[model samples]
Target: MTTPYPRVELGDLPEIDVFSEEFRAAPWEVTSRIHSPNGLARSSRGIEGLTYQSAHTVLGDRRPRIGFDEMYQATGFDESSPVYQAAVTSINNLEGDVHKVLRETLGRYFTRDFVQTLRPVVRSIAEEILDGFVPGEPVDIATRLVGKIPSRLFASLVGAPLGDAEFLEKTSDALLTVFYMDNANHEVVEKAYAGLAAYVEDLIRVRQSSPGDDVVSYLLDVERSGRITRHDVIVNVTALLRASTDTTAGQMGLVIAELAERPDVWERCHSEPGIIPAAVMEAVRWRTGAWSILRVVREDMNILGTPVPAGTDFFGLAVAAHRDPEAYPDPHTFRLDRRRPKPTLNWGMGVHYCLGKPIAQVEMEEVVRLLTERWTGVHLAKPLVTDGEPVNSRPLTALIGHTPR
Candidate 1:
């Protein structure tokens, strides 16, 4: 198979590197230029990679697997290490019946109705955190408000002790660095993963001895059936914890910041809570936390006429796909009225779509709803800035000043 567009060589396009400072500084600009003639391009980078920018072609294609074990082995981690075990065995890495079983088992807690049961838990946490912020004062909402909600909520969901949320959040950050940072220290990441494993093990032991209506107890029940082991419980719990923490926090930062900048948007959401859900979807489409999904090709195939070799790593760039004009009219502008003809790839596509999406949407809507209800207006003290390496792009720091309505 051959692409209708000419195959562009990586040597001819050096600026497309995701890790490059130039690209990170202006990713949308670079992605836009590279995708002018085609939706897919083969990277000259030695990793045997493909870069995809179009949502029209990339989503719902299952040939490209996350290849968690492949990446773990490629990175030279010891197979027996807790970090390696967690990385390679987590449900995020599993495929076929294994993935299906684990996902179905966990689905009991992550469903829309189940997540709604936690609304009181989420509102309580939001109220406590907001109570600490004085009206008309500048605070780094990025760190103080947006960051804490998800961490605390995840802690509550898994039945971790009340005071353990902050510690777990920090550990999750460190663990994420191992995957997101190009030059992250292996020893440091391993230590963080080890710490998380020990904590999860303790939590599991508590659940086993004294069951509760929480995720750990549910996993323990599954384990009792001999379908899964204690180790599986630890890994699955850690996966939920990690996915729920920083990624959600980052997306919250973007949503809140945007609302602050656009009073029309804020007032609309404030006056009509029903519209907050659509606003959250727009926020995700506009400023995605998951910039890309890493996958490895299982067999030789063609992507929009471009020949792809087996065992090649592919980067399905959600950042670029969300900005594709073909999928979104006036793609850069955030609009609640926008009807997505094709589903947004922010939460992912196909079987690997994010299971935490339901809870995440509820959390985002609540934060926006509660913040608007409490504050007349939320404005940035300084322009919200996004700066980071390719592996961990996020808002830097901005003090959000607010006034009582």
Candidate 2:
């Protein structure tokens, strides 16, 4: 950034090694040490905005571009390959007017009416999956029960057979490793992409013949209207399915795990159905860790008075903001009734905020509400095992617990 105003270089600020395991496992341990006056601090590659105001300013600003392609290129993978094509074309990587068009078009389908359509689907799936859990058993409910909920919902979204939900879940898991490049194998990703494409292609054909009031049918209408191509519908719809599969399931597991730890809160949810929504959102914030979007600085700029060079790696840290004492009063205390001065950045802040959030919430709220109602006492059998990747941590990656009445 080439700003005319006097600036404080990032090097002049305190630095935190945000990528370390310590930070990933317990982010507050790292963020708690930060004492920057402007709420912005330096990490190895970029600057992190710790406070709600600073994080919101950086994340909400439309100037900084998300640079997933740069990460893709670092893999030395073929740009024209299936994996590369899908990753680069994802709505997450695009910006400006092109991004706005796809976002708005997709947003059109994710309306309240569409989400309301999923209510019964969420309930039926949740009830059916809950039937698999025995009341007196000590079990890894996160894997055995909660994780399967979203994949099943994904099946409902595209009008696919419920049995195929596992396949969709597996493919979505591999494709999501695109963001976790270190764990990614291009061959596996390519295969996953090819499999998803074939599934989507077949699904598209079926929907064409037997049209229903589903997301795919709506997207097909857009394609037919000449606004987006058939190829666009296929890729974008595949992205949408991926969104529905992993994150929703993982977060739902985390929510259950969190509620288990707080029996008092869990009891409130069991008795007061209206509190389920707030409880679900609070779990999202409390269980979250620091995560940033890689941003491209088109010109030299001063962020919160810190001078960041044009070529530097810049990011907007949203998760960290969730714990900012200034933003969330008594941030560490998991209180559902607490007031929120600002919108939670979990779905992000600007143009790329998650479009699938409504459906995800439906699944979470319904699952939590139903579980609390059906089971009398649900507590953890053991501790949660997380992937511990700060930006993409699954707090309930492995949950083993006992549910005793």
Query: Candidate 1: where are CA atoms >4 Å away?
Result: 1-15, 20-22, 35-37, 44-56, 70-76, 181-183
> Candidate 1 has which clashing residue pairs, if any?
2-305, 3-305
On lDDT, the candidate that comes out on top is 2
lDDT of 2 by residue, 1-405 (tens): 233334566777778888887877666668778887677788876777777787777677777766667656555556776666766677777776767777878889888897887888889988887777776677777777777888888888788899998998889888767666553466666788899999999999999999997779988988888877787788888888766777887778877888888888888998898999999999988775326655666577778778677766665676677788888888888887876546777677777777888888898999888878877757676678877675666755444454544
RMSD of 1: 2.9
lDDT of 1 by residue, 1-405 (tens): 334656654334233567767766655667777633455554533221223334334445776777776655555576886678888788887888888888888886677789898777888899899999877899998888888888899888888876998898788777676554333457667777788888888888888789998899988988999988888898999888777888888878887887888888888888998899888788777776677666777787765545567877666677767777767778778778886445666666777788988888888888999988988888899988865645445676768989988
Clashing pairs in 2: 1-299, 1-300, 1-301, 2-300, 381-401
Count of steric clashes across candidates, in order: 2, 5
Q: Which structure among the candidates has the greatest TM-score?
A: 2
Per-candidate TM vs. native? 0.90, 0.93
